[model samples]
Structures are given as structure tokens and as C-alpha cells.
Target: MIRKANISEIDQILAITKACGERMKEDGIFQWNETYPNAEAFQKDIERGELYVYISEDIVLGCIVISTIMDEEYKSVKWLTPNSNNYYIHRLAVHPKHQGKGIARKMMDFAEELAVQKNFVSVRLDTFSKNIRNQKFYKARGYKQLENIYFPNQSEFPFYCYELPLKK
Candidate 1:
């Protein structure tokens, strides 16, 4: 089941992200690191009621952030829909142990449904340019690739932005 994250589950959520970061590093993905997706970020997401967790049998398997808040960096991107009002996705991660179970896809489905229900223009997110798997994942779901954005703290490489328009 997917639901809003609670403060008590923060520890479990952090563990999942830490493990994911390690696995990405081992795979030379270099997408997530110790500095990104830290506890503070998740804490804020929970406080704002934007963080959602995927759980099974009372254990948190993955988490995703769905918010209307747009990063300043996104303003420079050439989005397909031209409107800035969209569901912005962030900190999407699945526990390394539970990743192959399609938990991420389910959470994404939830996010897109929420967007459609709320009448949002689209869904927007950024994935590491080097993370080929992630790029394909979004593209397969009909998210159009947009201009690249950089988070210097994360890596020197660019992060590609994607948008899935729900309306014309």
C-alpha cells in the first residue's frame, strides 16, 4: 500500500535511501550520494505532507515525493506543456532488496493518478543523465525528455528533466 509518510518512519526511509545510494555507487551510477536525499529533506517532505511511502506487511519498501513546489532550476528548462503548474517528483527510491518488485512503478502510477485527479498540467521530474535505466523508465511511461539541469553538489554531470503532459 502507498500512503503519506509519517515522522516515525523516517529512520526506515533513510535506511532505504542509504542502501540505494550505496548500490548506485557500486554500479558507478553516481546519481545519489551521502549529501543528497538526506534526512533533513525527507523530514521537510513529511512535514509538508508530500512524501509517500510504499509499504508491505508493515515494512517501508520505497518512497516518493509528489509536490507542486518547483525548483528554481526548473524555470530555465523548456517544458513541453509551457505551464509551471505541475506535480514535481523528487526523492524516488526503492530499497535495494525490494527494487525488482515493481514498487517504483506502482508509486509512479499513484503520483500520475494524483496529478490527473487534481487537474494538474503535467508531471515533472529530473533523473541523472548518466542513469540510463532511469531515463528509459520515464521515457517508456511517456515522459518527454527536456533540457538538462545541473546540481553541482550532486555531480558535475547534467540531470535530464522529463515531463508527462496530461493536457494539451
Candidate 2:
């Protein structure tokens, strides 16, 4: 089940984030680090009602943050879709054990569904440029690669943004 994340689930959310971070490091992806998606971040997400979790029988399998709020970095991108009606996806992760079970796909479907429901024109997100698996995943889902933006604290390489236009 996919639903809005509550502040009460902060521990589970943080655990998921930590596990993902460790797994990424093991796989050589430097997307999240010691300072990212921390407790405070999740708190703010919950307060803003932007965080969602994928659960199964009361166990948290993954989480994602969907919002219309654009980061200053996104402003410089030459997006194919109009920026006005787009949703931004951030900190999407699935527990390592729960991966390969189509959890991420389900989450993406949910995000797009939410966008349509909210009258948004598209979904926008960025993946670490070095994470080929993520690039392939989004590409296969019809997300168009836009341009690269850097996170000085995240990686030496740029993060590539992708946009998927919703069917009218």
C-alpha cells in the first residue's frame, strides 16, 4: 500500500534511508550521504505532507517525497514540459530486500497518478548521473533526460534531471 507518511513513522523512514545509503555506497553510488534525508528532513516532509511510504502488512518497504515545490537548482534546467504544472520527486528509495519486487515502479505509478489527480502536467526528478540503474529505470518509464545539475556536497558528477509528461 502507498500512503502519506506520518511523523510517527520517522524512525522507519530514517532506517530506510540509511539502508539505502549504505547499499548505494556498497554499489558505488554516492547519491545520499551522512547529512541527507536525515531526521530533520523527514520531519519537514511530514509537516508539509509531501512524504509517502510503500508498506506491506504494516512494514515499511520504501518511501518517496512528492511535491510541486521546485528547488532553486531546477530553475536552470531546460525542461521539455512546462514548469508550471510539474511535480518534483525527491528521496525515492526502496529497502534493499524489497527491491526487484516492482516497488519502485508502483511508487512511480502512484506519483504520476497523483500528478494527474492534482492537475499537474508532468513529473520531474533527478538521479545521480553515475547510477546507471536509475537512469535506465526512468528512461524505460518514458522520463526524458533533461540536463545535468551538480550537488557540490553529493558528488563530483552532475545529477541528471528527467521529465515525464502526463497524458491529457
Query: Global CA lDDT of candidate 1, please?
Result: 0.93
Checking candidate 2 for backbone clashes, the offending pairs are none
| Per-candidate local distance difference test | 0.93, 0.92
- Candidate 1: misplaced stretches above 4 Å? none
TM-score of model 2 vs. true structure: 0.97
The residue-by-residue lDDT of candidate 1 on 1-168, one tens digit each, is: 999999999999999999999999888989888888888999999999999999999999999999999899898888888666699999999999998889999999999999988889999999998898899999999999989999999999999999999963
Q: Give the backbone clash total of model 1.
A: 0
> What are the TM-scores, per candidate, against the unseen true structure?
0.97, 0.97
